[model samples]
Target: MYSFSTRSSFIATPHESMAELWSAISAALPVTEAEFPLDFSEKVEPSVVDVLKRCRQQLYTRSGRWRQNAQIILDLSWEKLNTGTWRDVDKEWRCLYSYGCLFKVAALCCDDASPATVQEAIRTCDLGLLMGAAIMDNILQTIVRILQNEIGKRHSNEEDPSDGVSAKKMKVDCVSVPVVKQALAVPRIHCPSLESFKKDYLDPQKSVILEGIIDHWPAFKNHPWSIEYLQTVAGCRTVPVEVGSRYTDEEWSQTLLTVNEFIDRYIVVKDASSLGYLAQHQLFDQVPELKDDICIPDYCCLGEGDEDDITINAWFGPGGTVSPLHQDPQQNFLAQVVGRKYIRLYSPEDTEKLYPHQLQLLHNTSQVEVESPDVVRFPEFVKAPYLECVLQPGEVLFIPVKHWHYVRSLELSFSVSFWWS
Candidate 1:
């Protein structure tokens, strides 16, 4: 059994800067002295201590041999730490200290270590600490600081302009030419009355681009909607940003960050591996003040839903973002508030040719790349008929329910999509 006093000389006071953080963490842990056994007849394990000591000795060594040896030691130490439980204070403290030391070494070797190794090291340390490890407060504070600094360094490196290649200039392939059938443009009219829209397009389940309708909206005339204005209004608000050139790629991931950080890191400065997109988000719900800027079109009343039942979503991002071919359950009115977007639509009858994904998560999305599809792999895609159009600022495009559509930004854009039953 292990034994140690709260007043033992092994524990030291944490620095002033991290005292509050250390206190908060300590308060949350089951760290009472009464929980530990008092007897010290049995000796603590020596294997974890020896492995951690070796890891520290070679922490700065960047060679392949050192990495292989350190990884082996880390794996062994993690397995031991994960499987053990402690009733004695002294043994638990030693175990926690060893795991923290191992974490520090892994962080130091991060540049040369695999992502899996780094993740495992952090996970093991977190588990040990949470399992009533009585590590010194000062030591725990030090480990936390080191981890924070390493994360800061990684973010800075990603934003560095000298990084070789970036996703900012990547060209998106929008399929312009017809492969199987000749493509036609969607009909466009200026300021059509509600009666005309209901009789011609809505009743027939056809799509038409309506112009001169949204010019009266405050979003069109008053709000500049520039990068600066967006940052000023919604900068501090938390939002989910799509972090890749396209969602179809395996590397694509989503992250939650402030609108300001999204603009600073992704919009103002670009990232080589991924681009940030605020797409299909209910911005109005989070930032209700923005709702005053745009009004729902009169045509939305023709549907079964009331004004309050309409779902309003915002799509804001840089130029290269693409929405893969997909269908929605309700009628959609996509209003172009600021930039230009090239849109293509396919009737539900052509679903067989679109080749929707077999995976449940992506069932609504097509597997074929609409912009530059592979002829041999998706041969039927060429035979599907589609309507194409470039929607300009202040234009609204009516998309019938279950109509397959794909959209790509032609420039820095902000658009609002309204969905109603």
Candidate 2:
């Protein structure tokens, strides 16, 4: 449940409604608690099981609306999560908090299904998914599906927008940033045999721009990944978006928004308060229809791992959004489906010169901003040899494992990255 969402119909099937979903989720509490071996925090005052039962009892016997008890439960759980150093909280306590949100969802379900109701339900489900342990996957997914179904119904009969047919495609362009200066251009190869690519590039771990490879992707031809197309297909789906110019900024934060909201704020008008990126997400899993537009690069077989081992993430955002100089553990094929990005790379051989962060979490990232390094602060960074390029549509950049890279979009951008050992 934590890792995969099967098309599997469960033995204990869950129905889709606030009330029905609450019952289904409440019923699964015992089984979920049983599945986990009391691994984290073996002792607790009001155990997760105790909390769930008490909350449920309160719901059953409430003199007033369920909100009285439910709201109290929600407030306490919400406070518990906020009061502590979040990572130190017991996993079981997180699960208990999710039950509190479930009661609230059930209470909301007892009311009419208005836009506000649906939005509140979505917020509860998203919060539970983010903070709770994987104990209640089916319950959360059921609520999400129901909310999505409601959203879909609202737009089911609406025709495409008036300007839908002539929606603008992202421009394929380049910018001359300082980081890309005084660097060798990445070598380009046109559809070399997999054997040649591996022997010449992969084994030596060289960065290369691969061409004539992804041109055949349905997203570019038969089913263009136009703003209009994506809005039509995935607008209703809720997704986590990074709200800032870059992830490394102090102001950088995340929130949940539907695809339509993202497009409207960041894509269509470019008028958002800050940059919004639907970055590094497994979008294919959530909106499977979008998955059919592109195929995995065959070169991934060189990882010598099964296809299932690959990690695919979607990077969709407006121009000027930056990925500060960082290194990924696995080899990556960064495929540009729409728009363009100015990319700069450094060898792991120059790791010391790059001045990596001292913190464990940011150790993989360079302290120097590749775009505009402070020569005085990180003097050695100027000595690092690097390669740079402006990746175009239908092009893929083969990034060897641990090669430090920095990327910034030149226009509205959508790229898919496939990582493998």
Candidate 3:
């Protein structure tokens, strides 16, 4: 079952901030504690301490091996099922089954890919799902116990709020407000509009950015490059590039050059799609080491709240292309693989200090002439606690959402990264 879908047309406007949209949506569906219901039982509840302890014991000790083994079995089953038809089996399976393949593969890979891998993998999948269910059950039991304790407290407090309250009361009884679990039977936050995430994540019409490889193997084909007088941070030098003509349309289409052609032209944007069509049987295992410095982890489909997650983005020099200060929407692990990048970080509290726009269309804020930052436009920016990090090959940085940042590459560089919420 091959899966394919054409992308919708939606150009991202960096200038538009989520502030107004969030405010409007929230106003339309005002959440109130009064609307949040709680269901407490009359009987005293069991202590959560014991239940949590049990959950931890089961999760950490009893269930680990079974779950791991189950994952291994599933992987083998999948490989055997598809081996005949799929050449690039794993990648193609990914396109066809999406996360469904992940659940089975991870189960099989939980253990070594053994000979009886397929059957073992299916068995493991069942065990893993069962283990997961058991863990969830324990969690729910704990929640119910806590709720019961709260209800008992409320019953004992008929006379006076202060008189019935005791310091030794169960932690759950400390709740003066209602919980969603009590009222709705389920506790969850659903952001349905998050489905349209990719629509807003980037310039929709813009080509999906990738970390492309051009010259690989026969290493002599590409010249070794370095920049002198590079600013060093943590024993690495930063190469800054200043490419004018803000994000050209030509670059998005990859119309001007192929990645290999771009490499010869002294530029590269990572994407196999724009490169010459690769045959089903073709495999270039010997690509010039693009990231001799950094290591990128595998990718994952981050859940709901992070639907608008940014994947990987990279651009080679024609220096001085300033990426305006903006925070990635989810937790990000950024690595500087080939060249150096100067990064400035602002804490969440510093959003105001940086004078981030309230509109979603604005790409963070207009470039601050950092050398002589215009205090008039961003008066609050003066108070922002700015930290500088120069990423070189091999170093990775974890950046949380709402943490404002800006990056500038010093020279022609290549990099790879992974992100998940």
Candidate 4:
């Protein structure tokens, strides 16, 4: 009912209005009292379900014009207040909906060792925080309603809903339909089907050259893209550098000397498009096995590692060189040894909130810039929930793909990743 719009055959009924919808939600899923608190003096936190109840209570009184504002305030507060990090709260919300029930709120109950125990932390929270989370959640919910309505309207207008160009039938391309669908379906979470990818393209013992990997480093002292891009935005780009080698330490030192000399010379950004040797396409043509398994054009299998089902590769640059929000194809034990990057993650259940492009084959959405999103262009994006993480040298994130992600390097950065299917 919430997704229905006049353009589609489905019309908005009494049950779909904000007030009626809230009432149904309340009746169908009553809040469970947070029986315990983290501290004896404080009460246990209210479940998000309970929080929604309060929002609904207030929602019944507001004018239709103020409906959107009420939702936004609840959503923002939900993300920011109880969780400390808005990301965690967002994750919780999506998980609640995705699992098709609010019972998952039990996951947030308190543990003495942890101050932010699920129920206690939220229960004990002050009025300011409670109100804040409530407001934010409300906003997010309203935005989702709008986007869902638009998608339903489009899907309903289709001439052949059954034999249409849905996600199942889409082809991979420069603007991958699959990627787009995944991003939109769940803006927050990314769910890479590891089992499927492995059953199809599990390669062992892939190899890559030392210099070849460094060649993609955007933060390299001489990287032209770093200079050009930064010049256009910030006048300068200063990123830290660290070097290690599979070879002995002495060999690594010798390589560093060579690298330092190159840095002193000039900043040259190799055009990824022009550099055929730098890409996997040329190699795949030589080794056809690679062509079938390659997920994205930029993602390549460099060599098989010594471990079990471990594959080493240069993810190179993104397809857009800047990934739109989407998950990867495998469980990525990503290592960023060189350069720096910012990554934002969303859990699988956060799909509805993310408004992912809703096609199976594509893994990205049309939305860009997650924080302070552009409400006009990608209105659906405003409702997409996410958790952000930044990675530096020697840091690794065990990212479960299909868990939505957005990434950008602070400079020309180079990282090697091991993906297991």
Give the winner by lDDT: 2
Candidate 3, after superposition: displacement of residue 269 in Å? 18
The CA lDDT of each predicted structure is: 0.65, 0.74, 0.35, 0.35
Candidate 2 at residue 376, lDDT?
99
Predicted candidate 1 versus true structure: per-residue lDDT over 195-274, tens digit per residue: 99999999988998999888998786687566656754555455668887678878789876667677767666455344
Q: What order do candidates take by TM-score, descending?
A: 2, 1, 3, 4
- Candidate 4 regions off by >4 Å? 1-308, 316-321, 358-366
User: Model 3, range 1-421, lDDT digits (tens) per residue?
Assistant: 1121222111122233222222221222113322212222322123422332232232223244444443333354355445665444433222212222223333233233332443233333222222122221222222222222333344455535453113122111111121213321211122213233235332131111122222231211343322211111000111122224232223422232222233322332343123211111001111113233223332224333343353544344433344567765655656554556666666676566666656665656544554357898867667666566555554555555556767665544444444456
User: What C-alpha lDDT, on a 0 to 100 scale, does residue 218 get in candidate 1?
Assistant: 78
Which residue pairs does candidate 2 place in steric collision? none
Which structure among the candidates has the greatest TM-score? Answer: 2
Residue 348, candidate 4: alpha-carbon lDDT: 66
- TM-score, each model? 0.58, 0.74, 0.34, 0.29
- Over 1-421, each residue of candidate 2 has an lDDT whose tens digit, in order, gives 4323222222222344444444443343333323322233444355544545555654444335455656665666677778769887776667656666677775675444666777677777666766665444546656666666666677666655555424644333334544444448899999999999999999999999999999988999889997778876677666789999887899999988877788777665555456889974457765666788988999998887899999989999888889989999999999999988999899999999999999998999888888778999999999998899988899999999999999999888899999999
C-alpha RMSD between model 3 and the true structure = 28.8
Task: Evaluate residue 241 in candidate 1 and report its C-alpha lDDT on the 0 to 100 scale.
Answer: 80
Model 1: lDDT equals 0.65
By TM-score, how accurate is candidate 3?
A: 0.34
> Where does candidate 3 have its weakest 10-residue lDDT segment?
229-238
Alpha-carbon RMSD of each model: 13.8, 6.1, 28.8, 23.1
Judged by whole-model lDDT over C-alpha atoms, candidate 2 comes out at 0.74
lDDT of 3 at 65: 48
